[model samples]
Target: MKLHVIVPLCVLFTLTLTQQTPSRDKCVCELTHSEKAFPHDRLSTVEDDASKCNGNITPQKTVELENLLLGLEKRLPQLQQDVSVLEREDDGQLSSVLSLLVVENELLEIKQLINRLNITMLGYQRLTTNTTKELVDLTAEMQELETYDTMQVVKRQNDNRRLRRDLDHCRNGHQPTTQPTEPPHGNCPHGQFQNISGPRVYTAGEYPGSYKYGAWGRDPKPGAGKKSWYWIVFLTSSNKFSNYVRLYSSLSSLIVGVSTPGNVLIHSSNPTTNTVQGPNVVLYGDALYYNCYNRDAVCRFDLSSKAVTTLQLPKGTRFNSKGNFCHLDECYLFTDLDLATDESGVWVIYTTTQDFGNLVLSKVEEPLTLGQTWRTSVYKQGVTNTFMACGVLYATRYVNKVTEEIFYSFDTTTGVEKFNLGISINKMSPNIYALNYSPVDQMLHAYCDSYMVSYKVLFS
Candidate 1:
């Protein structure tokens, strides 16, 4: 085909240089392998070639290709049935829900197709087959999807509409703002979330000076007729254990020490097994959930009955291992699993054997039972910490010894991902292993280098 479009000399020169690069050899090999496998009934041994060409491709790109090939290989047999269903759609053979699912399935396929195209284009000049028409078609399809935020906008819009309707009803049911009184001590509320004004992440120097230091604790939720109360853990006077509990009454006139009845035992079912761990703790109902030290398990300590329940994590889960939870060489102490509490219940974020080192968020349904909540295939090797607030999952990355930022968020309700949080947390200590967000007081509590600090969350 004769080209009629004008091209800048510099652009052409750069393109030529990129094409002549040695990386194109691996791309060409992959493309040729893909073509041979597409026509053959036997599965392609592309993994072998991909392994040999590892240094030539980015790790992310390699993962994308692996997942795409696996999915495509598995779904190839369903393509004919899908086509039949598409044909029968004109005759109304498919239900609305099924049809919507079909659309989603196709969108997923298109997304993988785009990834393949990206790989193919990396070796543009080396391509033996004419891919101009395919490129044009895929580009057009992507443009159509991007106009509406690639299916994410649809879900977000639907969520906003539902929330707006609920808000309208709530406004109609709005009551006078009366200060709620504190319920009697030891009367813990059921598993629930506090009503918050909005979500926020306070930057350094922006947090109010009201929150005190010298304590590491679970994020407090509104309960027991009180708007905010924290379960602060402290070491006993003997320095042999950290099983003492203190309450930080946000509403009380006094902001000093207030001891509670129950003391948390830092041992497992066997009295000899010490389960003392740090940073992450969740308050749900009358039970406090935290990961057991050196054990791949979450421990639920009951305040009323003084009973302990241990929920074991999946096999291959990291725990108490050196260099397990570190983003870089600067490692934090004893961070294996992160426990968080939202409006509804408690959740634990940890890696599983099935997720290939990716983060999995599972809901704590019972004291010992964990319900699978959500899983993202994106690897969290760069994540320094994770916490849940208002059903949304936020992750932080270590920028330096002095700074960290909330670099990622996943909205469980809408399944949306955000990457543009510029909010920064200034740390006095080089190691900050623990982070939790309190909905009732709208604060992010952090345990940094043995010092406890609270940052006020300011909503935009």
Candidate 2:
């Protein structure tokens, strides 16, 4: 009986062991922890519950996991939308980069164009500079040539005049005088101006260079007991204006400081209105003619009556230092209106805006009327002084400190202009501020830097 019971017990024990053993060696849930895991069968409800209880998770952890799953579920569509937007932005970014590259290429082209323009401008500027220098040189050369041509013409004219004079003398059966003969008194029977002698008389008078601007000469028309009288008008007010004119019975009296009795006063006050304005003062026929102060007009101060008369100039006349006589070195201030006397009558030499700073001459008639006006082509500023003789206007220019050339002439009788008259004047001083021709003595009276100089006029 013992052996049978032992054998039965052993068999039961083996059966029990076989029943407790699993079907597979490992479970699907166990393999799920690895990356190589595969899905197989679902866990039973009781096992799922037991596995969750064995996971050591609390109630808070379960709620958190549920919220995480719900949040992921809600954000899945937004994530997909973000991916689409990023894909679109990639294409837009590529297009923007292409545009930037195009802009950079255009900028490089513009920079090259600007550099080319700068080079072109520099070339033009250099060309202009060279051209300007060449033009200046050519102008100077042309002026020199013109001067030479003028000298030739003047020499021919002199020869022709001399021949004419000799022929006349031969026809009249009289020997031609070796020297030119002086014309009769109050008669201009001689021919055109041929030459001018050097200053026959030069003296500073009583002033002795005390005044830089003034006019001194014998009057073309004198009253009784004033035939040999010489008058001087000193610009004592800042060397620009004057009011009194002093008279001397003779040039010797003027040199000896002998004051004559008829010292005319233009105005009692110095430099007042209607007083003498400039150094170009002229004493003609017992009257003083000068530029009216601060006006484009002429003022005539009568000595006998102590009366004043004014004659307005033409429209657009340049005065008050606007149209001054100028040379290469300097200009004479307030020489705009030049009052000159010839054998005919008193005349005015001025410039008008319509004539472009050229000379405009007009005859000043009796009773202060503007007579016939003559326009000249010569520039006023180029002349140093002008005078009238035999109804012809002669203009002088600066040559040297000791010489002045009379190179231009305008004939009112024939309306002819001659630019080749090369008569020269020898100067004791540098500048001649006031130059006037006297029909009475047939001389050129020049007020040159405070010196009164007279030149003998030689006619053919």
Candidate 3:
């Protein structure tokens, strides 16, 4: 009688064991442990286990994720019901309790996931008790992973780098490499931006001068991580030497720097001037580049050198008094007469001849020094265009040539054929003047007498 009972129990146990479970948590745990101990592809045994567990975990896990999302959706209904209850009760304590419960529920759910992940692998899914709410967020998960051990370090590092790169890419949308220069064969070093929400971030209103100062430059230093503020730099017109007579002597080009959200523009105290008119300004390699001699020559203003050095141009170079030329990797010059120099290293785009009634986009082999050079056409455009992100030259036009709101985009690298970005803005009617870019928001700020118009380019 005793033998018979024992045999039946043993058979039942064997049957239960035979029905294997595909445990995602178990697979992750086992796989990660193996990865730490050995290389990845050597995961034959682990793969076999995963294959065996496939009927149980992988697809199941996906279903679980879906269910979790569903649960989150369902949670809203429950919250609405609670909100109804709280609306009836005037007691602040009871209302607070309901809100706390909702938050606590989410915390508990997250904790369960972390607990499961802790037993398995997939690394960053689990966090410690000491970790703050911000630290556990998907956005902050990369930073939190610094506490990982050596075995998991490489995996974490790669994950972090990938996340950082992606974040930067998303934040820097629609911006071009460098500013637009001579079109054909001219190069602008492309830059990718990322969105990094740091702990010390000061919002639009929180940062003092930010509302008034406009945009600034971010620090690209190694460990600036979260504590860096982009310095917003602008020039104040001193109006000390504006007479047409001193065009040869001094023009007050006030260099102003300010910290964002602060209205106080940091002064040199004693305003300064350049020998010639300072038309445009650019920051590169700890130096400022601008047009001197009324935008005829490129002048380098070095913080270290403390003086402006004039770059010798090829003979017979001139700058338009009414217009400004942008920077390419090499630099560029613009004039009305169609002059493009492959050897001259500068390209000329004439608004009259190239576009006629429309806008002209042309590239002269941007003349650096006049020699045997070439000239080419980029776009014979109908819309007025300006340099935005990535030297991705953008163009805009009015439907009847009467509206103040302008719509813009680029179709090709050369003359504007089809570069419509599909984003229309209410802000600008270009006077073909005051079209400048602020690096802070990567916006082309078109300032009129009383207002400035800004447009956003979405380039991921």
Best by TM-score: 2
Misplaced by over 4 Å in model 2 are: 1-188
lDDT (0-100) at residue 327 of candidate 2?
Answer: 99
Report the lDDT tens digits of candidate 1 across residue range 28-90: 344343221232211123334334444344333333334345444434444555556666675
Candidate 2: clashing pairs of residues: none
lDDT for model 1: 0.55
* Poorest 10 consecutive residues by lDDT, candidate 2: 34-43
In candidate 1, which residue ranges exceed 4 Å CA deviation? 1-228, 234-244, 248-274
Query: Candidate 1 or 2, higher TM-score?
Result: 2
How high is the CA lDDT of each candidate model? 0.55, 0.76, 0.35
Q: Write the per-residue lDDT of candidate 3 for residues 1-460, one digit (tens) a residue.
A: 9999999999999988877755556433443353233334434544554454344433224333333343344444545655665566647786778766655554454454344434433432332222334334432543444334456777878899999999999878867676522222123332331111111111221232222212222222212221223222332333111111000000000011112233222123323333323222333333433444343454455544555565543334444433322222211222122221111122223343323323333332222232232222333233333433443334444343223223343323443433333444343222322234433344444322212233332323
Give per-residue lDDT, candidate 2, residue 299: 94
How do all models score by TM-score? Answer: 0.48, 0.59, 0.32
What is the C-alpha RMSD, rounded to one decimal, of candidate 3?
Answer: 28.1
| Each prediction's RMSD to truth | 30.7, 48.7, 28.1
Order candidates by TM-score, high to low: 2, 1, 3
Candidate of highest lDDT: 2
